[model samples]
Target: CNPIAEGILMAHQVDWLRIQAQIKLCEKGRRTGITFAEALDSVITASSQKSAGGMDCFYIGDTKEKGLEFIGYCAKFSRVMAEAQASGVSEIEEFLFEDQDESGNTRHINAYRIRYASGFKIVALSSNPANIRGLQGKVIIDEAAFHRNVSAVLDAATALLIWGGRIVIISTHNGKSNPFNQMANDIRDERYGDSAEVYKATFDDAVANGLYERVCYMAGEVPTADGKEAWYKKIRNAYGPRKSQMREELDAIPRDGNGVCIPGVWVDEAMRPGREVLRLALDADFVHQALYRREAYVNDWIDRELAPVMAELDPELRHFLGMDYARHRDFSIICPMSVDMSRHRDVPFVMEMHKVPTRQQQQILFYILRGLPRFVGAALDATGSGETLAEDTADEFGHNRIHQVKISRAWYGAWMPKFVQLYEDGAITMPKDDNLHQDVRAIETVEGVPMIVKARSQDLKDPDLYRHGDFAGAGALANFATLEVTSGPVAAKSRRPRQGRRITQGYA
Candidate 1:
């Protein structure tokens, strides 16, 4: 029989998530099938007869899109199980549900609900602590960690238990200090008593328990041990050097305690809002086709798009550029920094282009470089996919003005401190972007070296995160240009700092 066509299927930690419990919490890795299983369980709950032990199910996800996705799962499950047609359960419906605030003021919020013939309804609502207040029945809080007020939501969810309804909390941890993580830990420590049950699942756990096989089946491939292992290795290797991100995101470990390299307070102070930001966006096909013929299009893009943005800059200021060339799920980020008379390091422009063709990268980069004021120097990452870009940049910009940096522990140790020092001393300022803030904060001091934690491979379906530190790397390289200009690049022989004198301690 066809697995997916047969109907709702549970495997590995997914099966664990479906276990009957009055109160259940799932602390899981990314794409570990927890939510998928929750959707199936919800279907069963809403479809089963009341006397046979059925109850209404309410799913509150962290975003409106998540709510819709959860509902999509229900729609699919109902179709596969033939519940809607056979049992007369109504199709997914959009409606308004009444909710109340802490002050007891009533309001109506838009919601999606599916009514099963068993007289039980499964409702999916967007994340809002107040929205859950008047809700009764089994509550499933999906991505609980990312919710605005997890503690408050949990408080509201627990109210249903008084009427013998179940509460299911499902989420991947946001950070070690996140309230949801703390609650999961407390429950596991038995602080919530035996009524609380916590299920833990990691990427490795899913893989070991037939995740690859399921994926193969879904993709219509014959499941084989060798094929599964290959798929596993490919996914894991996609993370590259972001192991800490992997641990926190995929291995279900906390990262807040991993020694954050850039403090939030520092990032907050450096963030400059109300600054004009320049951006250039070209069609994917146009960029590819126009690469070799870039002379015509490139000149036009520079005159129209690039030149105007550069015209906003102070011509007297010495501008520097840093490039982190990347592709295939990673963005290629270019950050431009200026040294003002106040000695403040100002980042006036940050350009991030995704999946840009290689030749087009050179054209855009060259145009931007030629348009800069005083164009002192640029630091281009010379590692992996960046090698060709670095080589081309050196040829165009002159070797003295373009530093092709091969990123390494030594390079990170030497340059990252200077970058941190600029922040600590209030000599630097960056444009306001939440992802940029996250990129800086994602840096953690691992064994005295400050670097970005490479999280395990991210799902292609999910939007990209600064988890890879692309922005941070570009910013650091731009900062490195200033360091190189001032001191002619630190000697490659510079060894790690002496023990007890770690860079992290000075700022902490």
Candidate 2:
């Protein structure tokens, strides 16, 4: 006879216990009662005779509190199933677990256990990679994603399967980049063969299987339609603006990855030819050159190269600029965007500089700003060393026309979506260059925020060169400037003669 009543276990819980795979994993939502179901199964297994497929069960949770909770469930279940057993169950026993490593080193760990008359036992041990290596039994890892070393924990747990022992890994997703999520993906791809399987149980799944009603029953309150709706809404509303965290915890969806955000086709569709990508690379000795020499060199290059491009821009169209800054390693990119009557944003050209000194960077930037027709505004990366340049630019161009942006996760969450929307709506056009293409593709949805990934992409033409989404950042900042900066009456150029020493400009 079954010890559990017909409605005692939810559908997902029953399904979890029903899985007989040697290595089964469950990526589940919070408060789904999977742990409770597992506890009942563990008690049954511990009470069963050796001929009836009974063996020892070891539970490893991420926290000490979780261990106590699991053992409590086992104790309760053992008493409930007393009638089915020929012998009585022992009281909960607290003991030191002797964990041994390959080097014959042993360490004592605090553990709680319950022994059955059938010579089988249920043990709940503290979370530690070394704790699972020497155990020979069914291993259950709870909240595997939150473990200190998820990879190590998984590796040790899988070793149990070699000795005819079963392994169960259960957790809600931490992030897509997390090893637990990777393991789950590997399992779905059949990387683990037929011995392992992955199961998912979301909050909605549990609710549909009478979770809310069960909660009501436990609270000694009558369940109602309005009450259920209110309860569900309350739980969701508690997350506030943390929608990604809510989705990950309640929907079993993993957040963040190195996956491409903008597909190549989308980027390609937005690209147009005939756009210029001016580059300036300076030697190490450029910084030590005399000030006048540096100024003269850059000024000459600007007049020759930048002048022609500036002349081609429509004087009537409003323009904006976005800049991503770097000094030595990565390229500092400047993207100038012109908006036509149709509200279409066009990138006239992109400027890239490598190993260029800060003073020359400012000179080139000032010239570009002064040249852009009807310049509305510009956004500059003000993070780290870029702060000084951005602040100086804001001071020179008037604070109203320049935005010093502090690049961060929160900023990306707010602004990156708008930039992405431009591409999706076909409202923006950019240069058709492979490097720029790769830079834009570097954006990834990290923790549900569309931001550039940490990894850098090698320059297609120059393998020695690398980019950290320089153009993409500038583009996003430029787009932000256009949307956020208010367009005021254009200031007329001063007819007064310039004073003081003139800084020369030339290409590096």
Candidate 3:
């Protein structure tokens, strides 16, 4: 039957069927009808002639019940189309499916099948078969995230593409660390080279396309606006207090370990174009040159890049600074935050230094600190090599104004949430840059603490370089400074007491 003309298929279902890619994946919400759409597609494919792209279809669900459900859909659809097409569709046959492994090990799996007159059949395996490569056709893996070995199943599915077979993967997110979520990310990041595509369907997206109405019709209840609202609320409230789980299951957002702490959309919304990200890279030989030469080289860079950006800061606003320090490999990031009357934090500019000597880094940092209008306080990363710089800066600018932060898990637990809160509350804005975007996206939850992950992404501008969330750490520290540091103008302090004699008081 023509489900589309009958309005049986929703927009997302139709859109899914329209994609004829070799490999397509759907990361969807629970009960979004993706499996139902796949069942119809499987029936049509199995009924088509060989010249019209007919082939055997395999449905691999995580459990036996799911297999039965899929096979039932195929049976129903096949019988519906039989009268119109005059095709012979057989009854659902329960039999043993022979599965073989790479080592020639063989086993029998419980399977259900529906044969068609076109010599093609649709088979639903009760479990993930070891010999997926052995059956070549349109392979549909449902609830892929719940599979026993997600990575192994995905790896085997790719082999079907060699024989012009199409593969379809559909599931709701399990977690950020699940291979299913990772695969979706890989496709978005273009790791699959356009061979695979990922389609996302959240609960809200389905409701927008008449999911609630469909539910009402199925339940034989009249649909009303208030009823739909209450239905949505009921479903959301079902997972009360478990916000992460609710978001993952209903919103298609992945949570738990290794899940992205800051989504790209949030980062994109907070990013303000036209802001500057000053970069200074010094050669190894440049550091070995005479001290004056090194000083002059960095000074020129400061004048050309940093001076213009700092000149625009408002003197009336209180400013704070955070620095994540590095000497050679990773970037030493400096983030300066300006707080306005509305309590919004605006990062006027970000400064990144690579392969620069300690003295030069100090020179650039001190310049930015001094140039900042109404500078209140600054936080510096004091871990390892960073200690010397943090200490020196504290000594130069008063201990009360410069905080020496030693980053640790406890520290992250205390401060990272506040940093994340800045973005969540829309209280902060930063420069629009791809490298900075990658840096912020690197923050992931580990053991219940939010911190940067060990795995790094390559810099978009420089292929040879990688980022370890330097900007994110610095931004976090800068945010910490704003909360901890007393807000006001900083009093200038000299290195030494005045050597000259002091004037006597009038009374003396």
- Per-prediction TM-score: 0.59, 0.52, 0.53
Best by TM-score: 1
Query: After superposition, which runs of candidate 1 have C-alpha atoms over 4 Å from their true positions?
Result: 1-8, 83-85, 104-108, 129-131, 256-300, 307-350, 353-508
lDDT of 3 by residue, 218-323 (tens): 7778888999999999998766555776788888998778556665546766899998898887667767687876666666666666777777888788999999
Better of 1 and 2 by TM-score: 1
Clashes of each: 4, 10, 0
Candidate 3 TM-score over all chains jointly: 0.53
Ranking by lDDT: 3, 2, 1
Sort order, TM-score high to low: 1, 3, 2
lDDT of each: 0.74, 0.84, 0.85
Which residue ranges in model 3 land beyond 4 Å of their true spot? 1-258, 492-508
Query: Which whole-number lDDT from 0 to 100 does residue 358 have in model 1?
Result: 71
Give the Cα RMSD of candidate 1: 12.6
Model 1, position 291: C-alpha lDDT score:
35
**Clashing residue pairs in candidate 3 (N, C-alpha, C atoms within 3 angstroms):** none
Candidate 2's residue-wise lDDT over 339-455, tens digit each? 888888899899999988999899889888877878889999999999999999998888998999999999999999988888778899998999999898778777678898666
Poorest 10 consecutive residues of model 1 by lDDT? 499-508
State the weakest 10-residue window (summed lDDT) of model 3: 499-508
Which runs in model 2 stand beyond 4 Å of their true positions?
A: 1-5, 84-86, 129-131, 258-508
